[model samples]
Target: MASLAALLREAGHQVSGSDEGVYPPMSHFLADRGIPVQQGYHPRNLDPVPDLVVIGNALSRGNPEIEWVLNRRIPYTSFPEALKRFFLRGKVPVVVAGTHGKTTTTSMLSWGMEVAGLRPDFLIGGIAENFRSSYGKGGGDHFVVEGDEYDSAFFDKGPKFLHYLPYLAVIGNLEYDHADIYPDLESIKLQFRRLVHLIPTEGFLAVGGESPAALEACAGSLCARETFGLDPGCDWNADGIEMTEGRTCFDVTYRGKAFGRFRMQVVGHYNIRNALAATAVLHRLGVSARDIGRGLESFAGVRRRLQLRAEVGGIRIYEDFAHHPTAVSGTLETVRAAFRPERVWAVYEPRSATSRRNVFQLEIADALAKADCVAIPALFRPDKVPEGERLDLDRLVADLGRRGVAAWNLETVDAIIEKVVAEARPGDLVVLLSNGGFGGIYDKLPAALAGRTETTPGG
Candidate 1:
């Protein structure tokens, strides 16, 4: 939403917002852009009455600002609708949609287009390190957007991506997610299928071949369809992969012929798949393979997606926004493969609406079991979920133990920090996973670790 605000401000709109909690880098970004943000929602915040109020999905009917808008009958629209009306109209919208890798893939495609001298506009969900911001305005015809499958707003029950009239739709991969809104995988697939049906006949639909659900969603598409993945069967496939020194090198094949050799700074097979999807999109846009390779090589990645936060006492602490089972497993696998011979500690906080429920209890346990040791802090806002629906941390710990993995259910961020500081040794890698801020553990854990080292035996 901050990115959208930034874009709107750039387009010369008087925009201000109110939220319960606001923090950096979004808070800082907004401030840098000279946009004032009210600390909390209140009816008075709308006293001046803006032309149009943009409502985020997080806001409900009861929110004071929302109530004011409704009572006054003031014009209001969801974020997706605002984007379509204000920015995406008459442009070649390249909507990157999927359960995972949407932000990264969107960032890559946007950056790739920029490097190819296309100067395309883009609005990404996460902060792209290369751009140092989540949005951009370019003169090119294309506009890259991170198309979310989550519902747009309380009034708009349809998925947000449906509002983006995509000229080129890229489905990275599909899985059951957003348990609060989606009842099952089929329900989520139905949304993706709707997105596929939105593409024009001249447009293209690129999907990950590995996911049966993604391919199934693309069935009966009128547009040109392409599949990209690590599998040889994919129309665009990556092979001869190698990960070394935090970089991945691989060869790409297009339609059974060698396209080119590519290298990306990102690690993980999932990221490789993301890169392949982006590459396929760029290729479809008439970008040269040479420019695509250069763009992939120069890409700096998105913040919080396997970002290295701190290195204390020779122990590296990384932060990632991986709440889903697939993302958790894929991130751990990447860390294990990239930093072999080092213990990988998976510290997870089940904070997302889906993660707080028991929908992925077994799957999360299985993913965490891949780590040498797993630490699970108490679910954030556990009271929001019914007792019977909440994830059972005790059972998850026991499951990990049964798999011969050391596991602990620490109730607070402080407890998890203490355990990690004491247990982590030199050369260990601690990957903290959470979709939201885990009680600011990234800032607190590093400080605790640094203080612990000061009084340790080495001192």
Candidate 2:
């Protein structure tokens, strides 16, 4: 939403918004753009009633502003609709969708297009480190968007991707997610089915051959389908994959022809998978293997995924958005493979709707157990999920302990920080995982770690 506001303001639109909790850096971003952001929604927030009321999916019928708009018979539409009508439309919308790696894949694709001289506009969920913003304007006919399966506004029950009108879609991978809206794996698959149905038969559906759900979603879609993964049957497969400290090397092969040996600045085998997905799309677009390698090397990655916060007393602090069980597991595996730190501390907040629910409690516990030490901060807004569905952190911690992981269930980030720093040693890697800000723990963790080291005796 902040990205949309910034983009609109850049395009000389009068953009104003009201949110229950207005916090930086979004609030500051709006202020810097000279846009008025009214904190806390009220019926009067829509007094001006200038244009359509862009309702966020988070907002419901009970919201005062929404009530006013409906009562007054004022115009209203979802954020996705606004984005499509105003930005996407006839543009070659390259949508990157999956349970994981959507942000990274989209950022990579966006950057690849830019490096290939497309100068494509993009709307990513997370701020791409290379772009320093989640959105931008493009002069070309392409627009790269991070396509999410989450539903649109409360008024629209369909997935957000339904409105984007994708010309080319990349299904990186898929797993059960958004437990709040989706009842089961098949329900989520149904949404993806709807998304793929929108693709033209002449267009392409680049899917991860390894993801069962992704394969099922592409089954009946008339779109030209191409699979990319480590599997032998895939149209594009990564060969000779290697992961080192700050760089990765791999060979991409398609239809018996060696595309090229590519290197990315990012770490992890999962990232290699993401690169393969991007390679499939770029290859379809006719981007040369040489250009793809250059783009991957120049890519700076998206924020909050293996983001290094600080290194104090030889202990490295990193932050990542790995709340889901699969994502957390993949991140831990990647971090373990790359850093091989003496000790790995995994701190997490079960804040996402799915993570907060009891859906994957045991799975999450096992994922965190892969680390040397696991600290789970108290679940945020647990009441959002009904009492019966809320995650049992106590049981989860016990399960982790049974798996030989030193696990602690702390109530706050400060407590988690103190606990982690008390045991952290040189060459250890502390990874903080959460989808939300977690009260800006990434910035605070480094400061606290630095302060503790300075106070400890070295003489």
Candidate 3:
């Protein structure tokens, strides 16, 4: 939403917003762009009556500003709708859609286009380090967008991807997620199916061949399709993967022929698939392999996705925005592989609406068990979920213990940090997992670790 505001402001629109709570880097980003933002939402915030109101999905019908807009019958539109009307109407949009890897894939594609001198416009959910911003207004005809599966708004309950008329789409991988909005995996797949239907017959769909859900979602699409994954059956596949010294190198093959050898600063197999998805799209769009390789090598990656925060006394602390079981497992596996011989401590905060529920209880336990040690903080807002539906932390701990893994359900950030500092030794890797702020533990833990190191007697 901040990206949209920035773009709109660049396009010369008078835009102001109100929110319950705002924080950096978005708060600072908006302030830098001179976008006025009220501290909280209220009816009076709309007293001046702007020409149009853009509603975010987080705001419901009962929100003060939303109520005012409805009562007055003022012209209002959802974020996706506004983007469609103002930015994506005539452009060839490459919509990256999936439960995971959307932001990474979109960022890679955008950067690849830039490397190819396409100067493609892009809007991403996370800040891409290459561009140093989440949005860009380029002169090219293509626009790269991170197409989310979440509902559009109170007035529009459909998925946001529906609003993006994609000339090319990428379905990285799919699993059951967003339990609050989606009842089941089929419901989520149905939304992807709808998105696939929107692609023009002349366009193409790049899908993850290993994911049954992804293949199933694209089964009914009218457009041509290409599958990219580690599987040999995929049209685009990666082989000879090597991870060493915080880098990943692999060979990409298209239809049994070697396309090129690619190397990336990012780690993980899922990220490899993400690169493959982007490569497939760009290749289909006539980008040379040399440009794609250069783009992949130069891509700096997105913020908050397995980002290393600090290293103190040989103990490394990293942070990632992984709320689902698959994402958590992927992150832990990558860390374990990249930093060999170092024990990994997975500190997770079950803060997302779906993570707080029991829907993925077993999967969460299994995923966290991959680490050498696991610690879970109590749900951020326990009252949001009923007791019966809430995730059972005690059971999860017991289950991990039964599997010979050390696990704890520490309730507060202080307790978790204390446990980590006491148990973690030199050459240990600690990864913090959460979708929300996790009470700012990213900065707090590193400071605590530094204090611990200073107090330890070497003499």
Candidate 4:
């Protein structure tokens, strides 16, 4: 949203917005662009509404501004639709799509394009540290977008990527997610299939190897497809992958020829896969491997993934927006591979619509078991879910204990901090993961930890 605001402001348009709680990075970014934000939505926000209202997926039927727009019959469209009509159409749109790795891969590809002098227009979900913004409009002919499967709007009820009309699409990998809207794996597969069918024959579909879901999603599609991954069968495969000092170095070979050797400052073996996806897409678009290597090497990371919040007394703290089971598992795998600590503590909040429900209780427990110590904050607004469907905290704790993992259930963020302060020792790496800010636990933990110990104040 901030990126959109920045884009509009750069184009000399008056932009304003309303939100329940606007903070940081985004709030500061908006202010820097001279856009006024009305905190807490009100009907008056729509009184002097200008050209068109681009409703976010989070805004529902009961939102006061949305209701006012309906009452006054104001012209409106979803954010995706607005992008399609105004900015993306007629551009060389290279969309990075999948259940995960969308943000990191998109950022890598966009950074590579930028380094290669493409200066492509790009839209990513998370803020790329390289660009320091979620959206950028460059002077290049190509555009790179993080294609999301989330529904576009309350009324649209379709996958957000469908409207992107991608000239080139990357299927990084696929898995069942978003349990609220998608009933099963096949249901989610259908959306990817729809996205694949939208690609023109001249366009390329770079897919992941050894993923049944990706294979199934692309089955029978007419678009030209190229496979990339660690699988030897993939057209573009990574070999000699090595992680040192929280950085990944690997060699990517496409077909029989040597594509290039690449290294990323970011940690994770999964990141190597992300780099491969980005490299394959960029290479297909005429970006040389040398520029891709430079781009990947220079890349810092996305905003919320493995974000270093603070470090105090030799203890490191990180924040991640990893709510899904696969994402949580992958994050832990990366953290373990990157930072070999004396002890690693994981704090999780079951805040997402899917996580708050019982459907993923087992998966969540299994994923959290990867950490040395696990803590789950009580559901934020437990009443939002039905009585029977809400997460069972006791069961999660019991399951973790059965796996010989130390687990705690804290009802409040303060209590969780107290628990962490008591358990975490020096040289421990603390990772707090959630999709929403988890009541700003990232900031709260560092402050609480610093106060409890006789040491310097930091992470």
Tens digits of per-residue lDDT for model 3, 1-459: 899999999999988998878988778989999998999989888869999999999988678888888889999999999999999988999999998999999999999999999999999999899998899988899999999999999879999999999989999999999988899999999999999999999999999999999899899989989999999999999999999646899999998999999999998998999999999999998999999999999989999988989999889999999989999999988888877747989999999989999999999998998898999888879998988989999999999999988999999999999999899999998999998899889999999999999999981
Give residue 323's lDDT in candidate 3 (0 to 100).
84
Off by over 4 Å in 4: 455-459
Model 4 C-alpha lDDT per residue in residues 1-459, reported as the tens digit of each score:
677767777877888888978888778888888999989999777658667898999889988888888888888999888778877878988989998899999998898888889889998989899988888889688878889899999999998899898889999889878877888899999999999999999999999886889988998678788888888788889888888655788888898678888888888867888888888888888887788889999998999889889887678999988988889998887788778888878899998888889888899898999999998888978887888989899999999999999998988888889898887888889988988878778888898877877553543
TM-score of 1: 0.98
Worst 10 residues of 4 by lDDT: 450-459
Candidate 3 has what TM-score? 0.98
| Per-model tally of clashing residue pairs | 0, 0, 0, 3
Q: Please give, for residues 1-459, the per-residue lDDT of candidate 1 as tens digits.
A: 888998999999998988877887778889999888999988888869899999999888788888889988999999999999999998999999999999999999999999999999999989899998889998789999999999999999999999999999899888999888888999999999989988999999899999999999999799999999989999999989999647999999999999999998988999889999999999998999999999999999999999999989999999999999999999998998886737989999999999999998899998998899999988899998999999999999999999998899999998999999889899899999999888889999999999999988865
Worst 10 residues of 2 by lDDT: 44-53
Q: lDDT values of the candidates?
A: 0.92, 0.88, 0.92, 0.86
Q: Using lDDT as the measure, name the better of candidate 1 and candidate 2.
A: 1
Question: Where does model 1 exceed 4 Å of error?
Answer: none
**Candidate 3, which segments miss by more than 4 Å at Cα?**
none
TM-score for each candidate, following the candidate numbering: 0.98, 0.98, 0.98, 0.95
| True-structure lDDT of candidate 2 | 0.88
